[model samples]
Target chain A: AQRVTQPEKLLSVFKGAPVELKCNYSYSGSPELFWYVQYSRQRLQLLLRHISRESIKGFTADLNKGETSFHLKKPFAQEEDSAMYYCALSADRGSTLGRLYFGRGTQLTVWP
Target chain B: DARVTQTPRDKVTEMGQEVTMRCQPILGHNTVFWYRQTMMQGLELLAYFRNRAPLDDSGMPKDRFSAEMPDATLATLKIQPSEPRDSAVYFCASGTGTGTNNEQFFGPGTRLTVL
Candidate 1:
């Protein structure tokens, strides 16, 4: 079955510390991956996508097809970066319009 | 600026009552999606439409849940005899393109509570 998994429910980090949110997915065909973030009381927004190869808000994710992973990382976490992050995958099949399958999510708490 | 718009930021209703949620997709966005969010399940896609036509609705409950785009600008999700289990934050999102890489813009979800 196609699935997305985020092993940790919550992660805590101090200001200026390196942060990593793990994401793994299982799909039959080529996978299109994305990272979305939601700030407190805000709507969900796109953070980055594997194809873009662009970093957003000092965050970058690398798609490792061999490992079937697209983990988000930032060298120095900021207090403002604390938010709920979700990893999503869209299947490769062309028959259907893109449908996002999201992991439960990881809540990153950055403390001073 | 382009953004999806959803109505009734919050709703409280009794079971077995009809519930309607509406969404207005950004102009030029051909695809619209309905999703349900909960603390436990995160986000689950309930239905998707493109070009004012139904593409897929397999994720929704056929008996009680119905999703439609009566016109290009308006999309609605209706639940008849809604149950307690149906209580959730429903989100509407839209994107301009067709592929998986198309970035979707989401509206502030409607939080539904069943009493």
Candidate 2:
């Protein structure tokens, strides 16, 4: 079975400190990984995707196939960066195409 | 800007009542997805449609839940005889469905409460 795991339910960091939100997945085939963020009173939006290999809001995630991980990281955490983050995976297969499997999510808090 | 839209931002109903949630996908999007979000379960895909056809509904409960896309622009998820356990935020998303570019755009979501 395909699954995405975000072990930490809450991650707290001081402002300007580095932050890492761990995410791991178990899949038999190649998977598309994404990080979605939901800020307070705002709708969920895509933060970044592994396929893009680009950073969003100073956050970057590298897909490690060998480790089965796609941990999201930021060099300096900001108060505005605090939000609920979810790691998601999608595998293209018949009947399952366009379906996304999401992790339980992590609530990141940046304390000033 | 293009975005998926859902109706009834919030709903409160009693048990055994019928609940219907609607979604309008972003124009030109080929795929629409329904997801249930809860604190415990996180996000779970309920159903999805491609090109206005029912592709898969295995994630939904067959006995009381039904999902349909009346057209390319409109999709609906209906739960008959809703239970307290069914209370959650329902999110609708749209995507191009093209390989390697299948990023989904989610709607505001409908918050449902069952008494």
Candidate 3:
């Protein structure tokens, strides 16, 4: 079975502190990984994908095949960065588009 | 900016009532999806459509849950004889997946409550 796991349900850090949200997955083959964020009163939005390798809102995630992890990290946390973050995975096959499997989200709180 | 849109931002009904939620995917988006989000379950995919055709609805309950794309721009999910377990936020997302990433754009979800 394919599954995405966000080990931490809540993570807190002070402003300007470094933060990491851990995510791990279980899949047989190479699966596409993505991070989605949902802020208070806002809709869920895509943060970044493993393939893009682009940093969004100063956050970047590196897929570690050896560890089966795709942890999201930020050098400096900001108060505005507080939100519910979800790690998602989709099989590399053509079924990845609208059928993403999401992990139980982690709530990040960046306090000032 | 292009975005997916859903109607009836909140709905409250009695048990065994029929509930209908509507969505309008981005203009050119070919793939539309319906997802349910709850504090307990987090997020679960209910159904999806490609090119206005139903692709997979295996995630949805067969007896009471149904999804349809009546036209190019409109997609609807209906539940007959809804149960309390069905009370959750239903999200509509759309995207084009032929490209590199299968990033989906989500709409403000519909919050459903059953009494």
Candidate 4:
């Protein structure tokens, strides 16, 4: 079974508009959730983590236990925000233990 | 300016040939991870090491793929008898794997193409 799920493969938004990328996960106990971003010709970098409870580049994510979701949100989309976003979780057991299980990723494009 | 570095940024090989990719993790980092990114499956963890010791490689193909950390700074992923399906970008990430600073720093990645 897939541990992390990001439903949207592609999303587009206008500049200055709000944008949200949906992510959901399944885990029994507490899990560490993180969002990573990759820009063109660049390496993947950490955008933010739920544990840190901080926002980066105007983006924030909240982990909802009841819904099992950790959605990334931004108030205003910028052209620089146009990149691939991946939702990931670190498990505590088996193959996933101490390692991250990443979602397929959502490519967000912000149009001017 | 400590960052993960990978060698052979791009590789073009033939099917059934052996392919090897190398990574140099950030100095003092305790964990190193290998991942494969493709159009269909996205990013998949192939293997990971903690403190220069292999912790898990279950995500890798048992017969064809092998991963190892020769030292704290060096990690390698090798594929024997490569297939066209093995073509993808391979990334190596390094992190402290400790409290509050578990964020992984990624390398530029090795783009492989098998013909």
Candidate 5:
């Protein structure tokens, strides 16, 4: 059973504060991890992937294998960064390949 | 910029009514996906296609939900005799699996309401 878990339903922070959205996974093998964000009135878009190792809009996520976690982090939160974020996983090789399993999602709100 | 597009951004219909949602994947993308999102479920993948062929629709309700890709650029998801539980924002997404990423590009989605 492959699952993605986002523990927080809602998180709030002030501008310039650091934030972390926690995510955990249960997969048999090395699964691809991703973070998707949906801003208000906008379509969902890829924020970052574990393989890319690229930070988009100052947000970065590191996959920790030991803990089976892929937590999204930002050193300084901005008001524009507030959005609904989802943690997703896909098997690298299997019948379920390319099929994404998404977490329940965490809604982040940054107040100015 | 290339983007996946979905029609009928919003729909309000009574229970047991049939509803059809349309999607236009980005040109040249081989994979298309249909998903339903709700406050309770978050996001659920109903079905997906590759090369205009149905690969997996196991996530969809077999009796009332169906998805088809009539062409490379067009995909549709139909719900026959929809129920109140089916009311949610349905999204269409397209992607090309380039290496290990396979990042999906999503559409604005169809917000369906059932009474």
Candidate 6:
């Protein structure tokens, strides 16, 4: 079975501090990992994908195949970065589709 | 900016009532997905359609839940005889269904409450 696990339900950090949101996955084949963020009063949107290797909003996530983890990290947390973050894994059964397995999500609180 | 759109931002109904949620995918997107989210379950994919045809609905409850794409632009998820346990936020997403990183664009979502 394919699964994404976000161990922390809430992560609190002060501004200028480094933040890391842990995510682990279980899959038999090569997995495509993504981080989606949902802000208050805003729609859920993609934050970053491992394939892109691009950092969005000062956040970056690296997929560690040996560890089966794709943890999201930021050098300096900002108050506006506080939101609900979800780690997802694509089905990747051959075609490009939207059957993504999502984790329970972690709420990051960046306090000033 | 293109985005997926859903109808009835919020709905409250009694048990055994029928509930229908609609979604309009972003123009030109070929894949549409339905997902249910709750505090306990997080997010679960219920069904998905490609090219206006249902490719998989195995995640959805067959007895009461039905998902359909009337056309390329419109998709619907209906739950007949809804129960309290069915209450959750339903999200609709659209994607191109091509390339290596086919990211999905999600709608605002519909909050359903069953009494």
**Candidate with maximal DockQ:** 2
In model 1 chain A, where is the ten-residue run with the lowest total lDDT? A90-99
Off by over 4 Å in 4: A92-97, B98-100
Off by over 4 Å in 2: none
Residue B46: error of model 6 in Å? 0.8
Q: Tens digits of per-residue lDDT for model 3 on B1-115?
A: 8889999999999999999999999998888999998888788889989999898898899999999999989999999999999999999999887334678899999999998
CAPRI-wise, candidate 6 is: medium
RMSD after Cα superposition, model 4: 1.7
lDDT (tens digit, per residue) of candidate 5 on A17-110: 9999999999988878999999986789988999989999999999999999999999999999999999999777756667788999999999
Q: What docking tier does model 5 reach?
A: medium
TM-score of chain A of 1: 0.96
- Range of the 10 consecutive residues with the lowest summed lDDT in candidate 6 chain A: A91-100
Error of 1 at B17 (Å): 1.7
What alpha-carbon RMSD in Å does predicted model 5 have with respect to the real structure?
1.3
Model 4, range A1-35, lDDT digits (tens) per residue? 44999999999999999999999998886778999
Candidate 3 docking quality: incorrect, acceptable, medium or high: medium
Over B80-115, each residue of candidate 2 has an lDDT whose tens digit, in order, gives: 989999999999999986435778999999999999
Q: Chain A TM-score, candidate 6?
A: 0.95
For model 2, how does the per-residue alpha-carbon lDDT over A16-55 read when each residue is reduced to its tens digit? 9999999999988789999999997567899998999998
**For model 6, how big is the CA root-mean-square deviation?**
1.7
Q: How many residue pairs clash (N, CA or C atoms closer than 3 angstroms) in each of the candidate models, in the order given? A: 0, 0, 0, 0, 0, 0
Name the better of 1 and 6 by DockQ.
1
Q: What lDDT score belongs to each candidate, Candidate 1 first?
A: 0.90, 0.91, 0.91, 0.90, 0.92, 0.90
What global local distance difference test value does model 5 have?
A: 0.92
DockQ for each of the predicted structures, in order?
0.63, 0.67, 0.59, 0.56, 0.64, 0.58
Mind giving the per-residue lDDT tens digits that candidate 4 earns over B44-107? 9888898888888888998999998888879999999899999999999998764344688999
lDDT score for candidate 6 against the true structure: 0.90
Ranking by DockQ: 2, 5, 1, 3, 6, 4
- Name every residue pair that clashes in candidate 6: none
